[model samples]
Target: MARRVPRPAGAGAWGRSMGQGLLRKSKIGDNKSTQVDLWGGACMVRQVENVLLVLEYFAERRAPATVAEMTDHFGWPRSSAFNIVSTLAERGYLYEPRARGAYYPTPRWLTMAQAVSEADPVPAALTRVLDRLVDETGETAWIARASGLHVVMLDVRESPQMLRYVARPGMRLPIHVTGSGQALMARMATAEREALLKRIRYQAYNRNSPMEAETVRQQIADSEERGWFMSNSAFSSDLAGVALPIRIDGHAYAVTTAGPENRFVPRMPEIAAAIRGAVAAECGAGALDMTPLRAEA
Candidate 1:
C-alpha cells in the first residue's frame, strides 16, 4: 500500500477557507505561475486531494479503504476524512460494499475514462495494440499524434514493473527530439516535414540529442527505411525509447515503447518486434497506409 503525506492540525479548515480564494484568483491569472501556486499550496485543496487519494489507494491495493484508513494515511482529522469519503459516496464516484465498511471506486470513473479515450482521434481499435505491446515487452507503450510542433501522447499503457518509465496521458514532447517525433516526421511528406522542421527550435535536451536539422533529417530517413525509430538517452539520459509510425484515417500516429535505459537498450529488438506484431495483428495491412495529412486550405 502507498503511504500518504501527513497533514497538520486545523489543515482542513485552512484548506476550505483558502480553496475558494485560490479558485477565484486562478481564474483571473490563468498563467504558468498559477500551476506552481496550486501545487505549492496543495493543502488548500485537501478535500479534493482526499477524494483522489482514496481512489488511488483503492486502485493500488485492489481493495476497499475505510474512513479510519484514509484518516491515518493522510493524517487528516477523522471527521474530515469521513466527510470527504461520504461526499464521494454520495456523488456516485465511490460505493461502500458493506455497511460502515471500506469504500471502493465505482464503474463511473472507468466509464468516464473510456469515454474520454474514445473522444481522441486515435480510435479505439488501437487500445488492444498498446496493451499487448506492454504485456509482451514489459515496458510502457503509448500512441502519440503530432500536434503543431509537439507530439502529444494520446493514450498510454504503463509497464507493471515497480521501476519503469511512466509518461502521463496528454504529455507533450518536442517534435525535433523524441523518437515518436521522428517516427511521425518520417511518415509526413517532404514539404510538410521541412516546413515543420524550419519552425522547430532545436535545442539539445541531452548530450545524445541531435540539435542540427541535417542530423535530424538523416535520423528520420533512417527510421523511414527501418520502419521504426530508436533513441537512447537523447531526450533524457536515463531513458531510451523506440517508436513506429501507424497511420489511421490519413493521420499519422506513433506507437512507442519506453523504459529505463539499462533495461530498454538490451531489449530493443524484442520491444520493436512486439510492437510490430501487435500493430499487424490488430490493425492489419490497411492500417499501414502512411498518407500525409493534407495541407489545410
Candidate 2:
C-alpha cells in the first residue's frame, strides 16, 4: 500500500486529492494502487500524481532516487516503483548520469516548461499592462483567468516593497471572494456566471470576505456600476486586492493588484487607475484570451 497524506481539513484540501488509493494493491498497485480507474470511465490511466510526487521527491532530496528507495518511501511494491521510475527515465525526463546508478531528472522537463510558458495565452500586450501596474502601484500585479469555479494566476510581477504580496504563477483562488475571481465571474454570461456561482464552496478567512452566494452577487452588482472590484482581506487576514476585467485577443481575463491590507487599501485608487489605464493604453480594443493554462482532466 502506498503511504497516504493526512488531508488538511476543509475546502482547501480539494486541490490535493489526486489518486484516491489506487485499485486497493498490484505486486505493482498490490494491480490496483498505481493506476486508478475513474468512476465511470471505460479506460483507466496511470495516476499522474505519482509522477508529480516523484518529481517532488527529487526536488526536495536533491539526490537521485533508486527504485528500492522509491518503493520504501511510497510503500509501493518494488516492481511498481521500479516501473514508474524506469518509465520516467525512458521518457527523457529522467536519466542515470552514472552507469548502474540511481535516476535523476534531466533538463527535459525544465525545457518543456519554458516552451509552455512562452506559448502561454497571455500575450505580450497584457503582460506589459501587468508590468505597468506593478510599477505604478508598487504592489504585486497579476493576470488571472477563470478555470471552472476558481481563478488562476497566469502571470505575475511581484512588488519590490519589503512587505509586498508574493504571487505565484498557477496559484488558484476561489471565485467568490477574490477580486480577480469576482472580476472574471462578473464578466461571464449571466447563466454561466450563476451556474458557476452555485458551485462555489464558500468560506471566509476574515470578516471582509463574503461567505454566501447572495452576498457575492450583491458585491458584483455594485461593482458592475463602478467597473472594478475589490477584496479586502478576503483570502486571508492580511491579503487585499483590487481588479478590473479586460478583453485581450478575444478572451476575457482580469488584471489584479494586491498587497498587505495596511499598505494596499490606502493605495487602492492609485492601483486601480494603473490597471485600467494600462489596459486602455496597451490593448486599445483587444481582448484577453482565457483558455485553461492546464490540461483539463
Candidate 3:
C-alpha cells in the first residue's frame, strides 16, 4: 500500500466534492449498462416471434402443451409462459381443459391460420371495397366474414361523426339478429342454413321483438330476392342500416351502413347504391352504374 500524503493547504473544497462525484457516477454507469444488456435479451419482437413459433408447433402437432413445456421449450420465465397460454386460450385459439394444466389448438385457430396461410384473395378485394364505402357514404361501414355458427366483424371504418356507431373489428355478433348476418345466411345453401339456425340462441329483452326461426328464414329469403337488406329500428331504436352481399369467387362477404334512423331511411337507396358500387369496384368492374331508384322499382 502507498503511504497517504497530506493535502496541501488552501486546496479548493469544491474540487474535492467534484472528484468524489465523478467516482460515484462511473460506478453507476457501469451497473446501468450491465442491467440493460441483460434485460434487452427479452425484446418484444423476439417474444412475439417465440410465441408464433410455439403456436405453429401446436398447430402442426394438434396436441396439448403445458406451461412447463412452454417454459422449457422457450427458456422463458414461468410467468411469461402462463400469460401467453391464457391469452391464446381466451382469444379462442387454444382450448384449456379445467385443471388440466395443458392447452390444445381449437378448430378456430386452424381455420384462421389456414385462411391466412392461403393468402385468401377475396378478403383483400373486399377490404378495398369497404374502404370506398366508408369514403362515399361518410357513415361507418363494415365487412363481416362468416364463421362457423357465427359472423365475425372482420373490419370496420368509423364515420367522422362526433356521435358514431359502436361496431368494432373482431367483434362477434349473433347471426340471427344483425343485417350482415341475414345477408350472408340468405346466400347459404338451404341445408347449411337450417343446420346453423338450429344452434342459434335468440336474445329478446322487454319490449324488444324477437325473431322466430321461421321469421328469420323468411327475412333471409326476402333479403336475397330484394338484393339488399334494410331495417329501421331493428338493432336499436334510433339507428337504421342497409346491407348488401358481395359475392366474389363464390365467397360471400357483407357490407353494411348504419347511422341515425331519420337520415338512414330517407336516403336508403343512395346508401345502398354506394355499397353496391364499392362491391362492383372490388370485382374489377368499370362501375356499378345501377341506381337503387331503378332497382327498388
lDDT of 3 by residue, 86-112 (tens): 888888877876567788877886688
Candidate 2 TM-score over all chains jointly: 0.71
Name the weakest run of 10 consecutive residues (lDDT summed) in model 3.
16-25
Using lDDT as the yardstick, the better of models 2 and 3 is 2
What TM-score, to 2 decimals, does candidate 1 have? 0.62
| Model 2 lDDT, residue 69, Cα | 76
Q: Whole-model lDDT, candidate 2? A: 0.69
For model 1, the local distance difference test gives 0.70
TM-scores, all candidates, are 0.62, 0.71, 0.55
Which sequence of candidate numbers ranks them by lDDT, best first?
A: 1, 2, 3
Highest-scoring model, lDDT: 1
User: Which digits, one per residue and each the tens of the lDDT, describe model 1 over residues 1-297?
Assistant: 112242222111211122100111221112212111212122446666556656655654577778887776656799998888888889898898888698888999999988975685567778889989888998888999888887888888877776666555655677778888888887777898899888777665667888888999998887767767888777656788998888776667899999878888998878888888898899886676655556422
Clashes of each: 0, 15, 0
User: Clashes in candidate 2: how many?
Assistant: 15
Q: Please, what is the whole-model Cα lDDT of each candidate in the order they appear?
A: 0.70, 0.69, 0.60
